[model samples]
Target: MSDEELSSYLPHQGDRIRLRVHVRKEEETPRTKKNKLLTVLQEKLEAARKKKTTSKEEHNLEDMRNPHRPFGNRNAAKQNRMIEIGWIHKSNQRSTQIRKNKGGGTRKTEIPRHATKVEIIQQAIGLFFPNGLSSKGPLTNFNFDLWDFADREIDANVTVADMYERTKLPILRFYLATSQKTNDIGNTTDA
Candidate 1:
């Protein structure tokens, strides 16, 4: 499949497909422990697919409306929070949406898909042999969780960098705190 088609299957199709999916080798994001965790999650989701409880989130017209608060009420009344639980097509428009609203920061390319009555895609790939990849058959079975693990690790690194930039911490302080023997900051999940 072309990159466009491949990119379209991000979360899974079939408004009912849980947040789970798999990988073989090529389609797999990367080789890492984080990806492994994601693959495990996808497998678990697949297992639960029989129950149909792991399905995606469906959207309603009311979800698009803005919340309105009545007089003397601190919290606004909303029909329902828009919880995107399904796959939506990706595009450049999504990234610049925040810019249109006059918000700061980088463009958020990835937006949660709005679940509605529509067709979805299902594809899988492995760290070695990604599903739907333009290649010969005989795709290998791999621990899909590696993809998740790698993604998480990448996010973690990105988070750390964002923290450093946002917190504006001094280089000396960061190294000193991170090098503590007893505290062993590298073992810490904290930034």
Candidate 2:
């Protein structure tokens, strides 16, 4: 029988088509998949951006209706405080002395202003714990509770040592005498 006659007798149209053809199919690589994903993401992002721009007027109207939204001015107070603190200078010797008496230095001396923050902190730490950092004998225990109290009063999120560096507060130096003590005591004791 001819091929046509045989094909016509088949039950289904697909089964009648017996011719086979070979075609090369390319496999998708990771790089190609990644590029496709990136393109899709970019398209989605552009759509979102356009949507946001189109709705901006609506958002503006809402903001106008409720000018004093709690979320709108969340950082306003903190920003103002930061600005106020930034305006403060280390040259205010009288203020520094007062702060020093309170056990918190908030300014640096003119010469120490050029020093690094770490240096200032180390100096303050040395002054506060003269016997804690040394390698000698007869270590003396000093109370750091005053420094903590001063830090809280300053309310600048800065360490007592750092306050001394910035304000050149003489009170910090009063507590910073050089001692002939050893670190062994400090290492063994928990503060």
Candidate 3:
């Protein structure tokens, strides 16, 4: 091809080819709690810088926002306060008649942090014993108690937060047990 034909095929850079560019400007202020926390931290960081404090314990806003960082996001504190728990159907010689009343499979639930063992047992009774603890059938002579995974009887006064603090486990498993009520002579009675 001749130079004249090549020049016609390729246009010069001086041609009027117009293009539009768009830019977006976000609002300068942030109103959320996280942003407020970041602002506070930034202020503290600035103050520390002015004082020439050591950089070993100092963390930037990005580090504070990271979930993987244990000390910054408040997850550890929240995690230590709550626990997921479930109930299992446990049977003994006295509870054999009520064996068929085992409601369903273990359904794990997150109970309130301040819930006590008695409250948990009541809630579990509602779930595991839908027919109610009637005074006519197998429930007549027996009372229900909650037992932990280690087969230890749980105290009714302890809270779920206390259990979480003591066990330090995210999930705590418990079982329902029936104990026969006694009369004046400490002997089991069916009255």
Best by TM-score: 3
lDDT of each: 0.27, 0.40, 0.59
The window of 10 residues in a row where model 3 has the poorest summed lDDT is 16-25
Residues 1-191 of candidate 2 have per-residue lDDT tens digits of 55577567765656555432111122333447888899899999999999998799788888899987656445332211111010111121321222344333443322232333334445555433345542222234322212222332233245434555466544442222222222665442322
- How well is each residue in 1-191 modelled by candidate 1, as lDDT tens digits? 44446546753454223323344343557768998899999999888885464233222323345344243422212222121111111122231111212221121121112211111111112111234221222322111110111122112223322333444442101110001122345331211
lDDT by residue (1-191, candidate 3, tens digit) is 44455457545533212111111122446467998899999999999886665453354655767857657436335633434334443333433223333444455666677778887787766666567544333455657788776768899888777776688775676666656676789777653
* Alpha-carbon RMSD to native, per candidate: 35.6, 16.3, 15.1
C-alpha lDDT of candidate 1 relative to the true structure: 0.27
Cα displacement (Å) at residue 68, model 2: 9.7
How does model 2 score by TM-score? 0.23
Candidate order by decreasing TM-score = 3, 2, 1
Q: Which stretches of candidate 1 lie over 4 Å from their true place?
A: 1-28, 53-191
TM, every model:
0.14, 0.23, 0.46
Question: Looking at candidate 2, what is the lDDT of residue 93?
Answer: 30
Q: Who is ahead in TM-score, 1 or 2?
A: 2
Better of 1 and 2 by lDDT: 2
